[model samples]
Target: MVHKKESINRKHFLKDVFICSLGAYGGPEAHYSVFIDQLVVKKKYLKEEELVELIALCSILPGPTSTQTIVSIGYKMGGPLLAFLTMLIWALPVLIIMTLLSFLYQFLNQNNISSTGLRFIGPMAVGFIIVAAFRIGRKVVTDKITILLLLFSAFITYFIREPWIFPIVLIIGGIVSIVTSNEKNLWTPVKLNPQWRYLVAFVIIAIGSIALTFIWDNRIIHLFESFYRYGYLVFGGGQVVVPVMHTELVQLNHYMTNAEFLTGYGLVQGLPGPMFSFSAYAGGMAARGSGTFVQVLGAAAGGIGIFLPGLLLIYFIFPIWNKLRNIKGIKISLKGINAVAGGLISVSAIILMQKSGFSLENILVTIATAGLLLTRKVPAPLLVLFVLILGFSF
Candidate 1:
């Protein structure tokens, strides 16, 4: 009896360790959508309908739903530090991978062998982007006006190509929506917290970040600036971050090659977690030749840059999200922004099509993928997995 009891205790200890480590290591590998769904089902003690409703609400917002869901779960489980730790774990893997990739690319460029097998990734990536645009467009665009906006945005973007156009269009749509108001449920409040501590904490964190930037090296400063702007200023979701980062890191700072950026972006789409991991890849590559300390610092900075803003927004807004839920103006604005986001994705697809030099085979694949996404009940991650396999095989 004693031996059996000791064995049971040992098994329980190991099981706890495994779960904790899994949570940590699985951060980058964790699918934000899946994580949220499972947590609600297993841990939150929520019913199916409630889980669905929660997911729907999260999905409509600007940030990655998966990350937001996890943060929410952590907050519910253990408060702010747990939320922070969960996000930190989720971001760590990409940080490490991206830093290494950056070093490898730099070394390869120096050796002139960079083109050996990497050249193919570019066109393949364009194909993936084209597919993504179609997938997102089919769902978000329901009416002719939305379709026209999408096509017009694509055409304008293909030629003129300014980074700020995306957010500008979203804001314009929001303003127009507010003016055209019709919904009656716009101003109803759904309260979360009434205390001001969350807001105060956020301001303090921002101040600390600013102070840190001054004390750190230039690379660290650049990382903070890039992430801080990405988190705070970015209005739309993951896709918006791309253009913003391109403008800042690629066009302005010249931190990464266009090929490296796009490749990392494509890989991110295929990955299980949030798309923000692309920042890790970019930061890692950018940090190369700066030595080990700089590399680690750069990677950490990049990870923070990608996720901190959305996390902060969630914390500060949670108490007020329900209150603002029924605000007619906000709903209209969100609708308008969603329309613009659809347009942006559609435009991106068109660009990908041109760049990929689309053939019948590629066209068929894209059509099939989009059709599966729209008409069928296939999940996004499963579809992504299928495409990744298909992409490598073809």
Candidate 2:
């Protein structure tokens, strides 16, 4: 008994978790999502529902839910440092593999682009996001306020199509939440209020990062900026990032073609690890015109760049999440924010389809793929593989 206790005590929660992450595969659903849940449960690290709660919270937060979920678990097992380390471990495999794929593509005729099946991923990704939005939104859009915010956000976003609009939409939701929510249930002035400080610090860092982009427009900085913006701002999964990153990397920078973007986007679906690993592939494509070394560096920057903001957020926010969650006003705000996130995801599907040319076939695929996912019968990885086969047949 003592030996078992000692062994448990000696467990390096961070290292153990990190090692586990290296083995996670099949996007968010297959290995990453299931394995981590099992690990945390077997280790007695957290109650099953507790992890579920964390995941629910992460779904509303932004970026990759799996990444933030691991960070939160790591933080619970260790602390801030462990949380950061978990982010690195989670991303390392993806960075390496994506960079390698980038290097390999140099030998291939990217111009001809034979991955015809992979290109279908773009439309399917659109459908995937729509399905996800419905699933998430159905849970959060409880009343008129949330429904109004959801529709309002989606309407403005569909028309304006501005990346900056999301944060403003969220701010409006927060304000509406405070104004409309039951005042009696709000948390009273406690010993300390750190929420404002964290928000201010986050804003300053974001501004500083943007300023640095202007001052030093280097290869690395540019890669980071593109991904950092997407990683920080995007609320849903890869479905949402597809459109946002497309604008920043393709439309704005002209780093790669639409076909190239879709290929990588689809490819990541089949790959093991996080959904954001596609950024590393994008990083590679961005610098495919350059040397091998530069391509690898770009891949690293893209992977780290996109992953960092959310890593920082979960680390900073998770500790206080418990305190803030209980406040009625904050919960109301989160409800609104969740609705907005769903709205953003909804618009993203539309944006991706438009960017993909809005073909009848693409529309049909979107509907079919969305239907497959909504059934919840098929695993996402298998669905991706099936799509790959179908991509070839079609």
Query: For every model in order, what is the number of clashing pairs?
Result: 13, 0
Where is model 2 more than 4 Å wrong at Cα? Answer: 1-37, 56-63, 102-107, 110-117, 185-187, 193-205, 318-322, 358-360, 392-394
Q: How well does model 2 score by local distance difference test?
A: 0.71
Of candidate 1, the 10-residue stretch with the lowest lDDT total is: 1-10
List model 1 lDDT by residue over 271-343, tens digit each. Answer: 4445666677777766767786787677677777767767876676654655655555665666556666666
User: Which candidate leads the pack in lDDT?
Assistant: 2
lDDT of each: 0.57, 0.71
lDDT of 2 at 179: 81
User: RMSD in angstroms, all models?
Assistant: 6.9, 4.0
The superposed Cα distance between candidate 1 and the true structure at residue 195, in angstroms, equals 4.5
User: 40 in model 1: Cα distance from truth in Å?
Assistant: 3.8
- Expressed as tens digits, the lDDT of each residue in 146-195 for candidate 2 is 89988888898777755567678867876786788767857654443454
